[model samples]
Target: MRHARNNELTDRRSAASDAKAALLTAYRAAKTAAEPSRSARQAERISLVEAREARRAERERLKHEEQTRIVTLAAQKQAAIEAAEGAEIEARNSAENARISRVVEDEAARKAERDRRYAARKSRQA
Candidate 1:
């Protein structure tokens, strides 16, 4: 009876030890198997982050360029308006000078005719 009991105890202990070793081996194998996939997932996440940053930078650049374009166009439009106003003012001044010149010429002719008539009348009276 003592011998049988001892044998049974030893068998149970051996079986328990084997089960523990098997569980450890399975855990190690699973960790090894998942290592490549885990690293791949991390690399993919890093690439995605980098791509997002690049897109944001591109958007910022585009926005800046658009603003610059808008400012340039506004400045050009203002310059055109100023040039047109200056031309209009010049035209008005030219017209006024021409009218003054015509008035002066007409006054000079009238004065000459009146002086001639006065000289003739004086001769006739003498």
Candidate 2:
């Protein structure tokens, strides 16, 4: 009877080990069968990442261009303002110079008239 019990226990243990081995083989077969689809899914994920990166890069490029445009416009505006101020200053200086020239001409004319009067007086006295 003890030998019979040992035989039964051995049989049960062997059957359980065989079932575990079968389960392991099934898992391996399923993993192999799904490998192609898994790799395809990974490829799809990679492409999506690449597309997202491309969009981000494009957006960054556009933003940079816009900022550059804004900077250029601002610089142009500043230059125009400076040019206008310079023109105004030149006009003011020209006006001041004209006024000074008129004053000097008037002074010279008065001096010449005084000299002529003095000469006439001297000739009359002679």
Candidate 3:
């Protein structure tokens, strides 16, 4: 009877140890199963952050390009206006020079004609 009772005690202890091992195994499996999902979530978060940063950088680059374009256009417009003004001034100067040249030519022609008539009259008188 004592031998049987000792066997029963040993059996209970063996069963308890088996239950503890099974619980530990289940805990490890649960943690292992959750690890992949945790890692995936972390990777997803990193990707999202990277994508957002990329978009921001692209926007900034575009904005900078736009500003540069605007400035370049403004400079070009200013240069064009200055060129137009210079051309106008040159045209006015050319017209003034032409008028002066015509006046000088007319005065010289009148003087030549008067001198020719006087020379002819002097010859006729002699």
Where does model 1 exceed 4 Å of error?
Answer: 1-35
Q: Which candidate leads in TM-score? A: 2
> By TM-score, how accurate is candidate 3?
0.58
- List clash counts for every candidate, in order: 0, 0, 0
lDDT of predicted model 1:
0.97
Candidate whose lDDT is highest: 2
CA lDDT for candidate 2: 0.99
Pairs of residues clashing in candidate 1: none
- Give the higher-lDDT candidate: 2 or 3: 2
Per-residue lDDT of model 1, residues 1-126, tens digit only: 999999999999999999999999999999999999989999999999999999999999999999999999999999999999999999999999999998998899899899999999999999
Encode model 2's per-residue lDDT on 1-126: one tens digit a residue.
999999999999999999999999999999999999999999999999999999999999999999999999999999999999999999999999999999999999999999999999999999
Q: Over the stretch 1-126, how does candidate 3's per-residue lDDT look in tens digits?
A: 999999999999999999999999999999899999989999999999999999999999999999999999999999999999999999999999999999999999999999999999999999
TM-score of 2: 0.65
Task: Please report, as a residue range, the 10-residue window in candidate 3 with the lowest summed lDDT.
Answer: 108-117
